[model samples]
Target: GAGVSQSPRYKVAKRGQDVALRCDPISGHVSLFWYQQALGQGPEFLTYFQNEAQLDKSGLPSDRFFAERPEGSVSTLKIQRTQQEDSAVYLCASSLALGGEMAGYTFGSGTRLTVV
Candidate 1:
């Protein structure tokens, strides 16, 4: 894919159900980031991975949320026991390298998750 790709563009989860979102970044990209965007708010960084190694996860809101990129290509974000407060869009972004080109990041269309 030419740009970052996310699956299930929209999802409606029943309260307490677990959900998994997928992100497929551009091929060979070294840096991948996951962010959460509440309605009408800017995206907030959730975690960062550089080539299969998770370098930062400080932005993850709670233990119930987990993200991983085991092969440095595809990543998955899993949220457990979905709650109404958790409803938001999950964004995935990728860059060619760490702090490369200064063009910032290429963000995917994002997966909008709704909890009811």
Candidate 2:
């Protein structure tokens, strides 16, 4: 089974550009999650989805951040007008349940976004 994976592994953007990062989760898994991790910090939950339904999005820093899992499998996280404060490692993860767990989710390598 293929685990979670993200594209571009790294991203560089100007302060007001839009960027989209993609995530391909393990086949047949019903759960998906997104997280943001700053330098030297643990990953923080951004949003979660069970199948195609978004269960939570409270951790998304601003309206500029959006995410979706349309088919219950592949997901995308889009950040509009990227900000220097938004620069961080964007991680995608999946699990059996759509909730952030102390141990259930398996993390992607992450897309490290650096804004200037």
Report how far residue 23 has shifted in candidate 1, in Å.
0.3
Query: Any residue pairs clashing in model 2, and if so which?
Result: none
Cα lDDT of all candidates, in order? 0.93, 0.90
How well does model 2 score by local distance difference test?
Answer: 0.90
Q: Ten residues in a row with the worst lDDT in model 1?
A: 97-106
Candidate 2 weakest ten by summed lDDT: 96-105
**Candidate 2 local lDDT, residue 35:** 93
Top candidate on lDDT is 1
TM-score of every candidate relative to the true structure:
0.96, 0.92
lDDT of 1 by residue, 1-116 (tens): 88899998999999999999999998878899999999889999899999999999999999999998999899999999998999999999999867757667889999999999
Model 2: how far residue 39 lies from native, Å: 0.2
Q: Residue 76, candidate 2: how far off, in angstroms?
A: 0.3
Task: Judging by TM-score against the true structure, name the best candidate.
Answer: 1
